[model samples]
Target chain A: MDVVLQQLRHTYAAPGLEARTVLMIDEWQATSGAQILLRGISGSGKTTLLNILAGLLPPTTGLVRCGGQSLYALPEDERDRLRATTIGYIFQMHHLAPTLSALENVEMPLVFGRKLNAGARRARAYELLDSVGLRDFHRHRPLQLSTGQRLRVAVARALAAQPALVLADEPTAALDAESSHAVMDLLQESCRRTGATLIVASHDPALATRFDRVVDLRNGALHEAETL
Target chain B: MYELKLAWRNLANRPVQTWVTLTVVALAVALAVTVIHLNEGLQRGIIRASDPFGVLVVGAQGSSQQLVLSTLLLQGLPVGNIDGHIFEELRDDPRVALAVPMAMGDNIGGARIVGTDEHFFDLRSSQQAAPAFQLAEGRIFAADFEAVLGSRAAVGLGLRIGDQFRPAHGVEPGLEGDEHAEVHTVVGILQPSGTPFDNAVLTTVNSVIAMHAEALAAPDASTTTDHAAGNDHAAADLVSAAETVSAAETVSAAETVSAAETVSAAETVSAAETVSAAETVSAAEAAHADDHAGDDSHAHASAGQVTAVLVAPVGFIEANQLWRDFYTGAEAQAVFPGRELGGLFDLLNQGQEILILVGYLAAVMAALTLFLAIYSATESRQHLLAILRGVGARRRTVMLVVLVETVLVAMLGALVGRLLGYGAAAAIAGEISRRSAIPVAIGWLPQVEPALWLLPLALGVLAGLLPAWQAYRVNVVEKLFPS
Candidate 1:
């Protein structure tokens, strides 16, 4: 399913600062089986546009259609249900449940959907962890593991549900150069294997080259190019 | 299910808050249990103290009420006395089945000396089924001037079968000879009855009569030199009443003659004429005597008299209606034992009502406290609740999980509290039984309440309801409003 943004605009206002339009994307289209990179410097609206595409934030003006569903037209509950079933989120911080082990955290969505008992859920979580090369540390909490290992666990958790759309915000930002490359490789490999569309928001042009398409965000506008 | 997990995790996350709330609930449960046990125990004690024998009949002149208050309840002394003639008429009446007559006003060696019949012994002693006035060591006295000792009296006076001791004339201290009617033998000892009767020295009515008769015979007996007084260096033999003659006997003889004309100057020293000492003799003796005459006059004098009777009905229904007719007739006062007991219970139950109120209030407060604890915890878990909702846990399921957790806590607290209460009851039951002279076998049975299981279970469910409702009504969409 292709994602469409027609005259999409987002604005931000603070207590004392001048109100600014953070994002303005018109006639933006990401066709089925296409990858898009949102590239921008800090405060250049890369995250805002990606968030709009992820259906986590609504545009101030105009329509946003993700996977052929008009998110804004549905009630809040319906929109949340659609987002949970279809979209996979990978935040910069991973936002894993602290109380659960890595395996339980990965299987959390299946448990919520009542699709698995505790034993089945744990088994599926283990398989996903093994796929992400975290079989040895599947039972470890996020705090017990290193930053790179935690990111790997986050990737396993995001892809466990096998969603149609995966959205990652700075997925490799916390890793060093080598770890960053490995994390990017794992994310790309998982998305390719599952045939899911991946949208990543980042400032790195090196990561942009690996995707099918790269779009740059400059002066609150999108251009058909990636900048180093 | 997720909300329950979150609740448990949050409880584990804050150990102090959880412990404080649990401690409050536990203590409240314990207090409730204690109050229930105390109220129940006191009620049982009252019921035990007032069973089997329901009504008491005493001398009408002396206030039948006072006799019950004093003899049965051990609260006061009688205000007047009834004579042997009246007592005999009542005892021989068709309605009278069993009568336990008691006499007061004497103390022997610091123990009460009771003048009563063998029936009094039977009335005071209760065994497994029948009474246990059957002698413990020896036979009960078959004649006057012979006595039976209570268990405590025998032990306290160091008296045994065949041992002799003088009765103290009144409830006052003295080994005076005037008080010593011929020294009475202890023929039997009564078995323990767990009552005030155990502390009394009992003698037949004739023995009490003989004591006063001998006091009349020898007014100078106390003046005689006690031969056993300087007997530390001598044998432990007591001087016989026949051998204790002294100069005081002359004065005593003169008074006896003046007191009785047959023993007066008209008769030959009355040596061969053994005194009959019956009613006719006593009335004639009073005519010749001054103080004896006053006693005779008092004994027979009755300006106001009521024909009193004690009726034991042939059947239960007849017994119940006996008092009703008396009430309707308005001329007589008839008391049914059970009705009197019910009245007594009514009077006593007023205090128990206060206890019940306080106990009910405590239970309500406990429920409210538990409600508050669960509600506050759920309120603070709004964010976690939202996360659980987003995870796909049903609202009803979340509420049910919370309810189950609360129910578990309540059940556990109730169990612990009940155990503690019973343990406390068992520990003190012995001392209480001893002091109050009540018989209770100490065992594992909790005497608090038979329905105690229901109390905690119901409370747990009740306390869980509010939080369960809150969990059910939680809105999931509020968490993702900005989306």
Candidate 2:
């Protein structure tokens, strides 16, 4: 379940502009079940690196191997499937589909997986919602939930597929200090319980001490911070 | 299945838009359906009403359409009568299979009392096998002054077996006060024949000839109050009565006193009211064939005179020969009821085409409305689509959900519209049966009704195509990440 990145670099091209490189990293590694922090200044491509690892964006010249499979080497649909089964995502603003309930948002990945019947999917979603302390609010829509509660639901949804790696891009940026700490505790606890690698991308320096490793994405390079 | 569920949930989320879209679609389908069914029913109703008199009509040469409309359809006013020799010629013609005489211009209430014999019931021609008249209650008319009521006529007038009603002199409204001394007794009530005959009161031509002769012998004995003044319009009442004096009463002119010509001499043939060349005949021995259904004309007491002769020749050759003879003859003109009806529908079909054109336009508008409504729903929910894509739902599934949503709404609306269209058409047919003698029965229109449902479904699919594509090509990262 370990994730390996080798010589990954990404660039953006628009008409009449030089190709601008967004992310470049020689190599990075995470053991299965390890928690890590990625810190950088604004516009340093911390989110871009996480997107590549999540198989959402292919790197310009590198290999992303999650759970021993090269992600970008496969077709887009297969890559999507691999992402569905092997990597989970937590966006910055708790982008839960408003059409689905809190519990249904957690169950969405499994629905796309097509591997479980309705009864089994419901049971799994119930267990996860209970684990995230959203059992009573399982039936409530995302709009009806508090900000912290919404992020907690997102944490439950990210772990629903039992992925090998979970990527969080500024997931707690909009929360209060206490709520941010609580959201982080829920995400770390959930990832630890599932033995999945956790990668948090944020500009906040205070989150540096809470992971097994800390990497700084600065000027398209990865530097290991001293403390982690 | 999951995609359909998601689509339905999305549609349900926008209740107002969904209902408005469905309502527009239903109304559009209903309008199209009504036009289709109405056209179908009216055409069939006209055929039903025309089936009994599928014959060549012999009448005085004027408006042939007016003759058929009055005699066969029991509507309008008869063109003047023809010589009884013409009726005898048709009856003796070897090619003619059926020939029944008609005399008109008398009424019991607003219902016309037609003078025809039992042979009128044996009608069948090129159109279809007309069900012969059978008694539902009593027997056919036997002696003069005995009447046979049509099925609907009996029902409408609330008459039964042996019920006697006095005859009025004419079909005009005030003529009920111009009652004749004869009290006609109803001897029979006919079965429902699904024709205009079902609304008429039928009797013997001999009886009509006898009654008119008695009126001619009495004072103020002009026919239709027209011979003296030639002014028997529907509203001619007291003035006509005050001026009722034909040459038969004033000049004691020959039985061929030229009633239709008023006081003028050396006039058109009907001026003598189609009185044959029977040189010697006394009153009460009048032509055995006149119908004074409105009592609008009185016959000269000749041996041969009839308003119209229903002649069902053996086949096309005989019918053509007979029509040619009458067309060339000076006394009367001949008419084919089916051809007259065909021309009527040809005119009516033009108006129907316009209505159908409007229906097509409504359908297009309904389809466009479906397109715009579905497009907006998908447009506003692009974020949700992006989220689903982000969560590993395939683009195809997202597209299918949108397509399924639009079609589901359209199909539901169409189902309801089909019901309403048929209901409206059946109601219209019922009205025709009530107001006129046309017996219209509307069942499922197998020929064109399926298109009503299928048209909307195809439009639903077509309308959904663009919106589904929009949902498919929704930019995932732009919507999800906003970076």
Q: Of the candidates shown, which would achieve the greatest lDDT relative to the real structure?
A: 2
- For candidate 1, write residues B1-483 as lDDT tens digits: 564565566567556765665665566566656555554554454344434232334343424454443343333343334444444544554544555455443557656665565555444212334663556888765544457887867897899987766676544346644355334667789887555455567764433433433444454534232222322100001112212334354344334334443333343322122222212222323333342222222122111121232343334565446545554653334454345445655655665577657756766776677677777877766555554444434566667766865665666566776677666665565555443334333333354455466676687789889888987777643443323
**How high is the lDDT of residue B421 in model 1?**
62
Q: How close is every model to the real structure, measured as TM-score?
A: 0.60, 0.79
> Positional deviation of B465 in candidate 1, in angstroms?
9.5
Q: Specify the highest-DockQ model's number.
A: 2
TM-score of 2: 0.79
lDDT tens string, model 2, B176-227?
Answer: 3465544566879988888777877887654454445434544364344732
Runs off by more than 4 Å, candidate 1: A12-21, A31-35, A43-61, A79-84, A130-153, A204-206, A217-224, B54-93, B96-483
Candidate 1 chain B weakest ten by summed lDDT:
B233-242
When summed lDDT is taken over every stretch of 10 residues in candidate 2 chain A, the lowest stretch is: A77-86
Candidate 2's DockQ is 0.51
